[model samples]
Target chain A: MQARFSVDSGDFTKAGSASSAIKRMLKQLGVKPAVVKRVVVALFEAEVNVIAHSYGGFIQCDISPEKVNLLVQDTGPGIPDLDLAMTEGWSTATDAVREMGYGAGMGLPNMKKNADSLQISTAAGKHTEIRMSFSLKEGEDGVS
Target chain B: MAFHRTLKVRENLCKSCTHCMKRCPTGAIRIDRGHAQVEEAKCIDCGQCMQACPHHAIAVEQNLFEELFYFEKRVAIIPAVFFAQFDDQYSESQICQALYDIGFTHVYPAELGIDITRLYCVKGADCKPIISNFCPSVVRLIQTRYPSLVPHIGLKTTPSHVTALFARLELEDKGVGIFYVTPCPGKIAEFHRLAEAGSAFNGVLNMDTVYNQVSTSLAKNKRKFAKEDGAMSFPVMTGSAATWALSNGELAGRKGRSLAIDEIHHVMEFLEFLEENEDESNIDFLELKACAEGCVGGILTARNRFLASERLRYWATSLPSELPEPLVQRIMKQKDAMMDKMTTPIHEVSAIALDDDIGVALYKMEKVRKITDALPGIDCGLCGSPTCSALAEDIAQGQASIRQCTVLRLKDPKEVNTLARIWGEKVTGEKGEGK
Candidate 1:
């Protein structure tokens, strides 16, 4: 099964729709509650990141019996320092975003912690793409 | 332990208006055939269904008369809110004596246990926004609806259970069976939980049932228990802690960040906010009540809750506090006994388990998403469902079809027919006559 949803920057109202949809899907598929929670948490942070930092973005999720792969591609000023952005407290979110409690600099770190495999690629001043994969097997660590 | 729920619907009284179907916080109610059915797996037994039913179709389970006789010595434990229902002239001792006249050998008010628990709560809590565990319904809400915030809920046994334990300790050798005269369905259900864990409480009697009998006995009997000048067993805090029987009383006194939320919907909304805003560590205490005005506004209560709360304010304020030294010693002793193992943690409830396999459920949800996107988002409820999303869930589960949605059927009949035919083929797994 596959799903694609568009996310507008700073649109908090619709920010969680994609993550919620995928959560419902995973729940229906009979995934373990803990696994579904982890996947949803990772996807939510990724979705919120796209909406908070990027001008606009799209979320694509592909679910198989064994695993789930999520791709979030955003049209925004790409991360200049990937290593710094990966830090727990480092954030480039605007003041408005911070007031809405969106940019905690924890989104990437959280996504990394929850997802088994996380890959990132970006062209500065252009765009950013993130790929996260999660294992569906019960009792297994998220990435492997 | 086996799962138990107290809420039930009287099919004869149901009009099938779907009022409860839309209002359920857990999405546990479904309109099947003609009547509203409660899905037990998802139901937290919050008594919201009983309140929503205009026809009075919903009924809660209570102890039978014979169940009370089975116990050797029946002791009634009353909630502090029960005292607020009566006229101010009736002292607390008179109320306890009145309960004694109604089949109970002895009566113990819940204030003693509540005081001890509150003292421990104010002193021992380490986390911010310490969620109150006073309401059993609120505890069940955390178990099913907000599992992640379970740790934040303060460790404390309900006043009823705590009082029952104390009563058992007092009657150590005798076969003493404690029974709570409760005002809400949630506490009635909590009785079973206590019994499962080998508590002294034998069962619960609905406050409504005992109220009429006790009222009659109060009018007839002139006898009253010996009244003491300082009857209350806890220290008087100027702020609302003494009046915790009232809905917002939990917020009285103590300076740090605190919140007292009442009613089920407001509690859900606040909890959702707490879940999202993870950085809010400032709040030191949170008091969440399931009923509109705490237990006084329970479904089984006869008095007007607003009036009862007003009456309680006067009584709670004028009531005297306990003597300092003995009370302090009692708090210390109870603290050591209740440390670490306060209230029993409820098991996680999976209200909605769509399929046996994760991959299959995901596949079905994709189909549901497709169906939802196609339907009109007006939420008109013309198709017997409260919202378009609900219809999509039902359709995905093979309970309904897209043709039932009047908007799609009227505005674009062709689209509806095409979608129906495709859905039919998918369900049957074969080429249909239309194709």
Candidate 2:
């Protein structure tokens, strides 16, 4: 199964509506509660990243009968170093966003941990692409 | 959806023009061929489309005015946001005259309902985040979108629910009629769901129905009603009580370092941002309102002129009426229990855990990720879902295939072939049959 997302640029006031829809769809799909939790957390983190740093982006999902797939793509400023971005404490969020309890560097890492196989492709001047998989095998719950 | 009272649409009366789309606040209308089709997902029940349609193609389902006019004992349950609409009129005075002139035995402002909400949410001002239950659409929005955040909503029953309970209790024997003066689709939906659960919800009147009638009626009979500081409707009514209807009333109501976010998307976005960025400077409480301006600009309001923030501030300051000591004390107390009651996920139920191979799931994901690599990553929703992941999920669900996504098709002439090639398996037969 494939799902698509539209990450509207930050009006700050209207940010999380898309993520909310994703969470709802996850519920309808019978995604495990723990897996849904992980997806919500990770997807929300990526959504905020687009609003705060990039021009705007989208998060789409493909749920095969086997695996759950998520792709976060944005036209925002891409990360210069995949390694530094993958770390948990590096963020370039504005002070206004920090006032609201955001811009922490945990976005990519959280997405990585929730998704079994994570892929990142970014161009500093162009865009960033994130493809993550949360497998649905019996022993595995979700993204863990 | 079945809860709505059916209305007759004059079929041939439609001009088939796209004029109504521009007027709809929630984008509920779309002109197809010649008739207008209402998108259920998008419609907020705000009558802007009706006002916009020149041919009068739109009408409300089950108007309460018909029932309200016939009832023996009718009560007007006004939303706290109602006070915000008329800046010049005094709410205490108008409420008093309104009850008497409208031929009702009592006048209960939904503000009293807020008192009940405060009683439920405020005591935990230190730890619990209070998502306002005044608007039904916001709650449903969260239920559908931010299912995980469902836990964060205050467990307190909405003011409407409490008011419905209170009204039934007050008029035990009398032939009773409860007419809710609604501001938006959220309240209308709440009344609908509440009825589906039992059969208590009586009638609802949008602002367009009674705004003018009430104002004219009150003006005509201002002399008969006695008005000082009227009675409190519930336990939690406050100096800032009406503020709860607008942009940041919840923050002001709870008092500690609180954050109030209105507009459904704004609240969710802030939630996502708070999750990603916030630190030790924890927000003591959170207030969520779906309508940008609180309840006043609901799908049912008479005038849609004022900004939600400005009108909210205007109404909150106008009323500081005195309350009875017992009522004051009752409104001040906090509810002990948490609001987010059900933590269970609402996903699909599978019988024996069919596909449990993490390695296989991972490989399939990698293959899909690679197959769509060359497609434009734009989630334009041209393919149906609002995003790309939804389309992918649809593909996985068998409702749609990868070939349908133009972006994926652009990347490779044969999208399914590409997916099959990446997975190193034959997937064409039996269509997604591998268990």
RMSD (Å) per prediction? 4.8, 9.9
Assess every candidate by TM-score.
Answer: 0.82, 0.61
Tens-digit lDDT string for candidate 2 (B1-435): 332312224458877665666554433454444566665644544445565678877666545566776777777777766655555544555654664565655567676655655454433212245454445665555554444445556555566555555665556627787777777655666677567655345777776667667777767766655544454333334557666676666566345677767665575567555433233336656776665656655655655536544665755565564445776554344222223321112222221111244344434444444534633568554444435654454344344455445566566666655664444434446555321
Q: Can you tell me which runs of candidate 2 are displaced by over 4 Å?
A: A1-63, A68-133, A137-140, B1-30, B41-56, B69-71, B87-91, B117-130, B222-237, B264-284, B304-322, B326-435
Worst 10 residues of 2 chain A by lDDT: A24-33
Q: Report how far residue A127 has shifted in candidate 2, in Å.
A: 19
Model 2 per-residue lDDT at B374: 34
Interface RMSD of each: 3.0, 7.7
> Where does candidate 1 stray beyond 4 Å?
A10-45, A87-110, B65-72, B89-91, B117-130, B173-175, B219-242, B251-256, B277-281, B323-342, B373-386, B398-435
DockQ of each: 0.44, 0.09
Best by DockQ: 1
TM-score winner: 1
User: What TM-score does candidate 1 reach?
Assistant: 0.82
lDDT per prediction?
Answer: 0.74, 0.59
